[model samples]
Target: MKALITGVAGFIGYHLAQRLLVEGVEVYGIDNLNDYYQVTLKKDRLAQLQDKPGFTFQFLDLCDRQGITELFQSHRFEYVVNLAAQAGVRYSIENPHAYVDSNIVGFVNLLEACRHSSIQHLVYASSSSVYGVNPKIPFAVGDNVDHPISLYAASKKANELMAYTYSHLFHLPTTGLRFFTVYGPWGRPDMAYFKFTQAIEAGTPIDVYNFGDMKRDFTYIDDIIEGIVRLLPLAPQLEDVNSLEQSTPQAPYKLYNIGNNNPVALVRFIEVIEAELGKKAQKNFLPMQPGDVPITYADVDDLMRDVGFQPTTSIEEGVARFVQWYRSYYG
Candidate 1:
């Protein structure tokens, strides 16, 4: 079988491609390799993928409709996983168009391509940020996410709606995974965990937003990839409109919250990092920034029921693993 993975140099995408290639699947991976955080890190990821068998790397942007159309025509990929996006909540406040152009427009291009292709399944990344200040704990796949505080969250929500439309209109089979704060080895440097580790290691002060009162359903990258792997071949059949709240669209479409069902307090999360590195963080507590939410908890009951898998990695285990990789990579 063959697959096309967008943002293949990204943390989750990179791990997914590696796993599929190892399983003897031909993986065609593409990334614009934008300098969102660090181009070098993305290239480093690409370097590892390049050495693997049954893996092909391409320097392409999803916004290029001609390129994407040609790609769909040429590859005949059975599966497509779109992990590419303009990530970061705070960044979205400053640069909103990036989210619209890359996240919204680029997504439309991919969806159009999928509409025209014989694609079996298209699984794309939604986000926990879509929950957006809901007083409700344990954000579920069925919850109403109509009010998003950040453009980033809004863009992800838009993706879900657009995907539903395509699935309904064209009979396309699409799955959307609403990810929480995903972290682990080869993770994005812009993530709180990575920045916290770096600052603590450098003996500098790390900014603790909302005075460290926030909590996040921090998922390990391995766990995220495992969920996608299990859902790859299981395309949904159209269901009744009354059952829509359960994450089933009235089309060959489905959505699931693919995250750790556990939420970790930001302060406690920092403690785990400190324990791993044996260094205390000098925190500069501050008010919540714009587009910031106090907490994100995932309701993965549906995922567990359907996939028979749950994210079991503790914050302690995941942090220790990340610190080990960080020390080795930076040394």
Candidate 2:
């Protein structure tokens, strides 16, 4: 069994590759190694896999059409997971072009590649940000996500639509995982969890956006990986879609929400961080930023029904684990 993981150096992508390699599956990975964040951290992730068996990596970008085409043609990948994107709501407000290039155009390139190949399933990462300003609680796959306040969210929503098109037209079996707030060791530094830890340790003030009233369905990295692994071999089947049953077409496409069913308030999340660090955080309360949602709760009923699993990690445990890694890595 061979799999291809784009953004192989990313936090999620790296962890997934490690899991698959341990399963004795041949893994081919790729990443642009863009310096959107710390390139050193990305390289450290790759270093952990570079010496492992059944693993091969290439420096490639999804936006590179010819490169992706060549890669698909060269090797037969049973599964493909794309986790690369210009990831950040606030960053999108600053740099919208990056989102379009990587998330939109890059994704189209990948979809085109998968359509022409004999891939079993193409699982891509979507975001909870898609449920922009939605009044709905515990956002479900069936809920309407027609409106988006950020380019990052719109790009992810576009990915779901594009994948469905390929599944409908070309019979490309695809799955889109709408992830909630994912955090853990080796996570992105730009994330609130990581930033809060950084500032608290540095004795600086952490900005509390939305007056620290926002709630998020914080999911652990391991939990997210488990959901993906369970779904990889369980691609959507056309037969599963009855003519009068589902509202959509008879396509081999599935979408699932990978999240802890519980939503954690920002203040509570901070308390966990503070408890783990054993340090008090100086906070600066602030109003909601543009393109920011006050809450993100995921409806994981469908995910549980399909995969028999949902995220079970608590913020306390997850935060402690992250702090342990942060201390060890930084030391």
Q: All candidates' TM-scores?
A: 0.97, 0.98
Please give the RMSD of candidate 1 to the true structure.
1.6
The top-ranked prediction according to TM-score is: 2
The lDDT leader among the candidates is 2
On residues 1-331, what C-alpha lDDT tens digit does candidate 1 reach at each position?
Answer: 9999999999888999999998888999999999889899999999999998899988899999899999988889999999989999999999999899999999999999999999899999999888898888778776778899999999999999999899888888889998889999999999999999999999999999999898888999889989999999887766622226555547888889887888999999999999999999999999999999998898888888888998889999999999999999887
Instruction: Write candidate 2's Cα lDDT for 221-254 as tens digits.
Output: 9999999999999988864432123666788888
TM-score of 1: 0.97
Please give me the total number of clashing residue pairs in predicted model 1. 0
User: Which pairs of residues collide in candidate 1?
Assistant: none
Which regions of candidate 1 are displaced past 4 Å? Answer: 240-249
lDDT of 1 at 276: 93
